[model samples]
Target chain A: MCSTCGCGGEDASTRVTLVDGPQPHEHPHPHDHTHDHATRTVLLEQDILAKNDLLAAANRHRLAERGITAINLMSSPGSGKTTLLERTVTDLGDRRETLVIEGDQETWLDAERIRSTGRKVVQINTGAGCHLDAEMFGRGLTELAPPDGSLVFVENVGNLVCPALFDLGESARVVIISVTEGADKPAKYPYMFRTADLVLLNKVDLLPYVDFDVDLCLDLIRRLRPDVEMLAVSATRGDGLDAWQSWLADH
Target chain B: MHELAITESIVDAIVEKVGDGPVAAVRLEIGRLSGVVTDSIRFCFGLVAAGTGLDGARLDIDEPSGRAYCRDCRREFALDDPIMLCDCGSADLDILAGQELRIVSVEVR
Candidate 1:
């Protein structure tokens, strides 16, 4: 089990320790100082997510130094992300090294599914948090210890709204939306679509049975991100899997 | 929720800067287009700050309205939604403001 995040099984490949302890603050002066009685205003002028961003940059540098490619895969609940990952890993068997860092509010299921494919996988349970921050991703990277030139997919928690706000220092961000969901998802969740490097319209096999308008969904996503690359994929039915794999290789 | 994490981040930042000193108040500037709900943060602040130096600190927030520039109209206007569009019926908008999630100042005792 992961001793740090407390989310894993006994046979887990990696144990990721998340950031939950007190920060290491360096003090220039060790001497005792007198307390002031008057109230003082400290002008910070700092961005709220600056710390996260800095940590993400560090993570990016570390990954780059090791020649590792990290992909941040995100989507809402039941977007077939895990299934897609399983298929991707299975199809790329022995051809390339793939590792997964699975994030969920409360679950070992996704990680287990990925691990069953004989690939190294780690799970992160955020408890109540909606998104995986940079520090958490860093911890995951440390535990995974991915080999050089390996592909590490960080599967984010199932939430389109919050996950888009946090940068996990990945080489690319892939947002997946299934045909079972609304066609206006891009319009409703503009932030997710706006920040995506690639959009995967999954469950194309079920398109004929569903009411989802593929063209409309693509149009809405294009409206938000004019030149974002997109693909129609059926992770369950093996449709457009080659294109997805090629895209990954190209990236 | 993400707000809980954001609140924890705020407390962590404050403690890092002030070394657990008594914080009287914290001033923040949240933008309308930042995708964060101010009420959610306010609700999570007290809980996340309970054992920290900012336990009793007043959480003061300034919400900045979103502003964007329209390329077609060659004018700036307010934007309240993430689906940005200009008054001239153009989607080519350059956001000028409203994504600010900043910690402006902190009153320490």
Candidate 2:
């Protein structure tokens, strides 16, 4: 049994109403004996993410049919994800009706940052989970209610591990890595890189000051995800912002 | 740490799948590259399954090695590490498998 939060043999799981659906409920069934007490294995091949995946599929179809392009942004803590969004919002500035869904373990700080740009945004506090699931995205989509042809950016939790397992029904997944951090991040967190449609190598201005090797980083990222597109840019200096912006525009 | 949520998902799926019946055991297929901690999920499962029909149900985890296809060497191999280069020392590769996370069966008496 876990001593912390009593999560081992108790109801320590997080209770969240992030989606509009029937909540898991319990009903007493005395007919549990209908099996004649005979042991039988039920052939049920289902993904553990099946419930979440179904919601994600629905979200994907909904977004596509609505002509809304949603992007899932993932990275480790302090990867400058929010900073890039700030620039994107300010630069795009009326070009696209953008909405943001910020996921965090706790706090409304990221949402506040995006809010500073005067754009529509919502915050999701996982409280216990490490990543935001598709159900949460569905709820966010409903709450945001973005207009047709609008763009949405789902800023996932800071951690890279668990978020990769979840598909939030976004049009594309973008993983951001800063040169200030290890270049081998793609190697260490392969799932994140593998699932990403594009990788934004942020903070390129620090490349010279830092000892990060761009070639090595690209090679490592390719190993985990062949044919993954990458763009080197400094969110602070606005260097290479055109490519990043165009990437969004094209997508 | 997110294993708690993962376990909750497992409990929710099992409950919805088996209905209001006493589940005796559950068989799972966890790919080595699924990035899930089996032990943590096990611990969380015990906690989350207490009130459901899956209470006291034994969990059986089957591991599947991660599979990959190396384009440089034009060879396929099982990936134990994502950064692992091909036999030709090339990082050009495409992952083929080892990302599955699913339940294969559920036993009830």
Candidate 3:
């Protein structure tokens, strides 16, 4: 009999052990064990975007508490967002304190342009990053010195795809599609158009020269986002800017 | 793409949880409105998991349906319809679900 346990009946060669030690416990057997086929459903139940959304919500509350109205401006490169901001700042500088948060992959050129307007401006060079997230916005807000009853504009990196997914705690999201670009922009990038609160058809001065259809573009935008407000303006020539300024005044 | 960044985060999370174990499979719940392109995520998964602890692990995605509630009609309906209309033909509605994005669970040996 074995000396380890009283239940031992035979010698080491004759005795059969049902359970083995922890030596190979890590590697389970490959046999057709009944428990192996048992379906164990686990309710992990967690949101991957929950963390980002929580941060965005907190940022929104902070903006509200500080009496700041935030706007996220999205568009393709060379959509004249900088020019529009320059005109807006020049027009509304005396009425309300305005700040611009410029996001670019590299260079502080846009921020320099806005600074000439004599408004509070902060530039975020994403450094090979495509989009701006809530964390970056939160950090930029501190440096931008967001004042109460002020309007804050976040000019997202010049892309329509990734920025649309990120919520930068902006009260409004405006998508700018210039008339120089194709009129099918609203149709091609439906997700961005659908998510935007407003769409600005910039560079309307080129309407007569370029093969652009304003009505067709408006129709496509309406089909995608029925409630989205739209404005047509030419920042370079200062056409239809009074209406834009009035809209800003009301906001 | 942003999916590359997201996949990096997932890989970091997995390495933290399971050091070097043989991960059998991973199940992810991707919501319809999560704005994550499923194909891009899958492509990113393959690229990010290469030569890592999660090599050869299968990715299973569960795409759940979305729902929206109509404030005018006081009812809930599917979000896939052409129009955001309620039973009473009202157009104003608020999205209620299908905005999820999560790594639900994993099977390891």
Best by lDDT: 1
Clashes of each: 0, 0, 1
**What C-alpha lDDT, on a 0 to 100 scale, does residue B56 get in candidate 1?**
77
TM-scores of the candidates are 0.86, 0.86, 0.77
Please give, for residues A1-251, the per-residue lDDT of candidate 2 as tens digits: 12223242222222212123222223346774443444566756666776776788889999999999999999999999999999998999888899999999899999999998999999999997789999999999999999999999999999989899888899999999999999888888887898889999999999879999899999888877777899999999998899989999999
* lDDT values, one for every candidate: 0.85, 0.84, 0.76
Decoy 1 TM-score against native: 0.86
Name the candidate, 1 or 2, with the larger lDDT value: 1
Model 2 clash pairs? none
| Candidate 1 residue pairs that clash | none
Ranking by TM-score: 1, 2, 3
Which residue ranges in model 1 land beyond 4 Å of their true spot?
A1-38, B71-74, B87-92
Ordered list by lDDT, greatest first: 1, 2, 3
Candidate 1 lDDT score at position A243: 95
Per model, the share of native interface contacts recovered reads 0.71, 0.86, 0.30
Least accurate 10 contiguous residues by lDDT in model 3 chain A: A9-18
Docking category for candidate 3?
Answer: acceptable
Interface RMSD, all candidates in order, equals: 1.7, 2.0, 4.3
Candidate 3 local accuracy as lDDT? 0.76
